[model samples]
Target chain A: MGREIKLALVYRDMWQSSGKYLPRVDQLVRVAEPIVEMGCFARVETNGGGFEQINLLFGENPNVSVRKWTQAFNDAGIQTQMLERGLNALRMSPVPADVRKMMFKLKKIQGTDISRSFDGLNNPVNLANSFKFAKEGGMIAQGALSITYSPVRSIIMSIWRINILN
Target chain B: MAGIGRPVSIGKMVKGIRERHPDIIIQYHGHSTPGFSVASSLEAARNGADIIDVGMEPLSWGTGHADLLTIHEMLRDAGFSVPDINTKAYMHVRSLTQEFVDDFLGYYINPKNRYMNSLLIGPGLPGGMMGSLMADLENNVKSVNKWLVKRDKEPITQEQLLLQLFDEVKHAWPKLGYPPLVTPFSQYVKNVSLMNAIQLIKGKERWSMIDENTWGMILGRSGQLPGELGEEIMNLAKAQEREFFTGTPQDLYPNQLDEFRQKMKDKGWDVGQDEEELFEYAMHPQQYEDYKSGKAKERFLEDLEKRKAAQQGLTSVAMPQTSNSESNVMPQSMTIDVNGEKFKVQVAYGDAVEEAKAEASKEEPKPTSSGELEEITAPLEGKFYLTKDSSEIGIKVGDKISEGDTIAYIESMKVINAVAADKSGEVVEIVARHGDDIEEDDVILLLK
Candidate 1:
């Protein structure tokens, strides 16, 4: 068949990461066809992270936007995914289990096909709920470990140094 | 990881994950901020990453992720079965993005964020937080410089302020237990660092302006940190009587969906075709309220129009007016305030302008203080100090001083403002102590 899909263009986050606002739903609709025609991204990230918050800030109902926009991508035979904060679940603080489950259920109904969940601390416990709930809502559960770099430290050397200091 | 990792590290991590769980698919989400995106993407893919996240042009690189075209092409070149990106559609999307930027979003974007910063390697803040970080830097620099200008001090540059803030972030990250520099945690680290930098710049000590949210992170309410809290922070927490948290962070926030549902019903808000609206409301209560009340829209529209007007003003040139009179020229000096910052502009015309400029440059001899007792008063209400530290006392009783000499300093909101003498005189009486709280027009000394 055609080349296997291995890329998910995070369109919403691009707008947020580059500037301060997301594209309006109409703008998203206009670009969705072209993005699908490109045949590059297997999935497109329509919303996640700051999506709902930003939509609220713009005085738009994010649910409406998500439904309309993700529908466009799903109709085109492309999978639609959202970024989910593990434990936080689209928020800065820990979200309740029932509310978090409802988020996945509602998002799946709103045409979202996948939930790429990540925990800031890379804590597995925080992400366990997301895996369970996303699958329960008939969405593909993708777990991501937040990555960062640190100079490799020798723990044994450190312990020896600590003992010497003590 | 908030910051990007080296390609080798990413490859190792991906390979380890792939080996441990062959059925699991790995996706590496890395930012292009540190200029290591292309290499890392390739490494991740080679090491068994099933998907790689990327962004489109006009929104790629800088604080955003690497572009899809580059990653696709690179992966294919490296012999991966990646799908071909339709060049025509890519161009169309690119053009559409540019159009969006030109329409209004360009005014909000900081141009500095368009390029990669190697310095981001130190702080490792993810691309998501970089937008606000740059914006905060711009606002804080303007504020600090304005305060400095009022005290007749030289203005600090954005680079200088950013560098100090970066250093502070590096310092604060480990001190606060090396929480992964991501959302909520990253923001907390950044806010604390920013506050510390501003305070340090104002001659105040670090951790002097830690807010409650930062305290939350420090107290371990968010979660377990990767490292121990610094002794200084622990001591401060002890002094504040804030207890440490060792329980599950998520359990602290119990199930509150029913509460939110009841509240939404009271407000007559729809729960959407699904319950997505309720979820949004529950997640962000204040923002949702503002959105429903139309306050957010009003504020956003006002800000957009203000930015648009400013752009138009900057672009429109002043056309010279044609006059019938030939000698329509004169020497003038005036002060103009731009966005609340004052600037003095001098305009001079005629052949003798050079000579006049030279003549004006010469300083006129000043009459010494009207030969009377002069009181050196605090220019603002703040803590007054006679010296920067104990090692040096700037002025004592019976010390001679000239006009414009910094007789004392007044610190307000952590910013130290030098109080200068209005006229030349000998210090006759010292009235304020080194650490006394003083007010505007409060005399620090009597000079004669």
Candidate 2:
């Protein structure tokens, strides 16, 4: 119970959950040192998921952003993480296994130390593949379970349940 | 998990996961929506969760993850050895984030996403998707209201439409096999529900307008559904003759890393610092292409400027010109207005050429006859074009035209509005030539 709890500040998710755009690479660069100095976070989520797509929307090279931003954190003795959508691999549709593996390699080379990967449907097959690729590509793969609430036998569920019960 | 779980349920889940595999580390990621995430975080930590994902304020709470400062204090109070936060550094990061929100991104965020909506608990939509969902809901509501107004019916409010959509999602989720309401799948369910609501509003049947992507999700293209597809969708799929996939989703998307690498080679693009650029292209082909071409940034900045101007209550900038010499070589004088103050400015292209000025004077409009000729003045200030972009033929001398006829087109603000004739007449002479920048009340055509 006395163990030091590691806190990873989800910077990418904070903006994405609140607004439509991510801050420019220059803006992120300015704040990266201040974030490391905050002294509570063990890790900072640099980019992934919609991060690259949002950077493209701003007409900036996401590769450059990830490299410089993660380097800033790594230099400050803080680890960096990226959100990965398991089989989808940073996009909505399914990605080829070869490209998915290369994503982990590229992200790791860009200075990201961890990859927090999740399958939206909680498919174990997808998660297993993500962990294998991420670890093989030199990243600490943090498998995620997407949780949701489901009421027991509500009006809609009752109909399906009744058909089975009968 | 996505932070939507109750505290007790989260505790049980974390404990259960730890019990099953004691060596595996558990990190809890919960959202602050529906007011349960703070308690959920505490419960998870107590139940052997190794780490907690927290968001820094002023970007915390609302639909984002729980606040770092609050969670750290709470965890420390609960006897956990949480790390100390530098107050000054925290304050600086908070202000920097606020500055970003105020700068431009604030315009696109729905204020509703910043508050815990208890109403969302029933539909169980994830907090991360709530921001974009509300944005799409706002847009969809506007379109629906506009349609209703056109039909002379009572318009619905965003709140009303959102409630309807939630209801439809509740219905559709069960029908679509209750896939975990997460990214991609949650969006798929929300979109189909939104379409159903819109169709019913327009007096059309549900499932009348299903998109291919939604069909793909329903037919097992993403993966095997946990539950069964509803009878209606199944019947509709059968009627539409849509094929259902029984194979693994990844098998359908074979290895294409080499294909993308070859594409980057053909385009002569650098593979970047360890092929990161190529990875971006392989991931999102269209968006990466737009970014490489510089079109994305141009449009993004343009939209930001427009939104900023609108927020500042400024209309499109207009210059009040006093006069402009017809000759290109002459000094043109105009009035520049800044904050309601006017300053006279004169700009000269170059030293005046005598022969060039004479030629410009000669090109000026002349009377074809000494008789009374009617002047067809421009109704608005714009670039006067003798024909639309699609046409080449124009009104010429001696051409007969009828009243209410479109004699020429005037392009203003990218819209080509037809300039109609006031009375039927024969064109005696053309005054405003093609592509001429004519002002209001300027004679564009001479009629007889």
Candidate 3:
């Protein structure tokens, strides 16, 4: 028999995809609760990755929305995940190391089971601190390899391996 | 990065990583910038990537992430073990998601965004910027058409302008040291490139419309560039000459937890242990404050509804007329009704004399004994921010400031240019207040 693979579904892109399809926070909460309860996903990539920006853009309190979503996932007995941009965390720009640490700590506390961290440049050096912080904060640190093609792919491959091992 | 669209290369890369670190969990995040992310993702998985990032089919392709359905099917077809995702449930969710995508097509889709560009491989515009660049191109073309019409020249189509902009972006990338085209940085590159393209289209000299943010990036204020910036580019940037930050950019900004807390307190917001709200306020003060004050939320919802109505091909219901001009009036306080709620706003025009006198009275008296006071002028024309936060003790009258100390910041073209003191001396007076628009070489502060 083939090995059973766990499939994690990332709906964070839906926030962007929905574009004008933006439902109110309450509406999203109502619709997502049943879907999350279906219990099919190994992990639901539900929050973070511009959730704050969308909330802000739509005039919803991000904290409230995040809290509600996380709680819903928790109630459904499903682990929730988010993509963290290494040192950048939630903000567009690179935040202070202290701020990045705090963000991980807070997310963990708020019930973020896993943080799939990646740097845009695929720089392992940048991912190191975020990985450390995520582990320290008691969350699973899923290191992301930003897949890009290059003639000298060996250099990045080595870096990616080294980053994960370290 | 260059092999983004090449799946075989990605498979090789992933295989190499897998071979090196057998125990490490690998997730693949691919963008459909060059319209090859789905294939690339499957390649990554076939080689050894454990987790592949994929979006719903409705939001997939053309600069979006890889489609989940495609990834699942390809992985299964390759004889790889797959997850037991309920196909029926997944499709149900997708159907709902498609409804949302359909509603938002007007806001998200544009002519430029609808097509795949092979040229994107050279400039490497991030997936996130696709929609925005399309919107920017649309706006730019409209302006260009207007200009052409005024000049009695043939109006160029949006496609032509988009191609020109793409060409300019490719040219600008090397000049800007090829900073990773991501959020914040992507916007910076796009702005500089767009400005350059527009200026070129108008037959203006190169670097004639250099945005301050681009200037700052060129000076290494934003972050380190990937390559050596050319001497000519640096010389052109010197025209808007300002002190460039040599050290790490984050060093210039002090922690503002206490200041934000205080602001929250002053605003009568429920100051609690929520770091999330604090972080939101820290990153976007004005927006957060507006949200907290119950103004921005109302406006956003109203705007969103209007857009939604327009998207549905339904006529937008007329909103109650509120005087936009009254909102702009300064010193004159006015009560305006928005959605039946009245908000009293008092707008103070530039440097109210009474407020200035009151502030001067609060400060310590200036010393009489001094040499001739020298004026430190602004290096460029921009809005001067006195301090990053209210808690920050900026240079005031009778305060000793050192040479190269950042007394204020002049924000122009979305970049904050730190205003440093040329010579160390006691601040005799602060000529420019917070949010004051000062001209080039205007006196910002007086030093004795």
The candidate maximizing DockQ is 2
Please list the residue runs of candidate 1 whose C-alpha ends up more than 4 Å from where it truly belongs after superposition.
A1-5, A151-166, B1-3, B318-448
lDDT by residue for model 1 over A34-145, one digit each (tens)? 8888887888989988888888877788887888888768888899989998887887656788888888888899888989887776666677778889999888998766
Among all windows of 10 consecutive residues in model 1 chain A, the one with the lowest summed lDDT is: A157-166
Better of 2 and 3 by DockQ: 2
Per-residue lDDT of model 3, residues A66-123, tens digit only = 6776777777777789877765677555566666676677777776789878665455
**DockQ leaderboard ranking:** 2, 1, 3
Instruction: Please say which candidate is ahead in DockQ: 1 or 2.
Output: 2
RMSD of each: 13.2, 15.4, 11.9
Instruction: Give the per-residue Cα lDDT of candidate 2 at B64.
Output: 88
What pairs collide in candidate 3? A149-B3, A149-B4, B331-B347
Q: Model 3, residue B410: displacement in angstroms?
A: 12
Q: Candidate 1 or 2, higher TM-score?
A: 1
What C-alpha lDDT do the candidate models reach, one value each? Answer: 0.73, 0.76, 0.63
Q: List model 2 lDDT by residue over A1-166, tens digit each.
A: 5866788799999988887888888888888988988888888888997898888867888888888888889888898989888888887777898889999988888899999988876666677888899999999988777777664223233223223221
Better of 1 and 3 by DockQ: 1
Candidate 3 lDDT, tens digit per residue, B73-162?
Answer: 777877777765666666767676666555443455553444455667766666646665665554455545544444555566666766
By DockQ thresholds, what CAPRI class is model 3? acceptable
The TM-score obtained for chain B by all candidates, in the order given, is: 0.70, 0.69, 0.66
TM-score of chain B of 2: 0.69
Fill in the DockQ of model 2: 0.43
- The candidate maximizing lDDT is 2
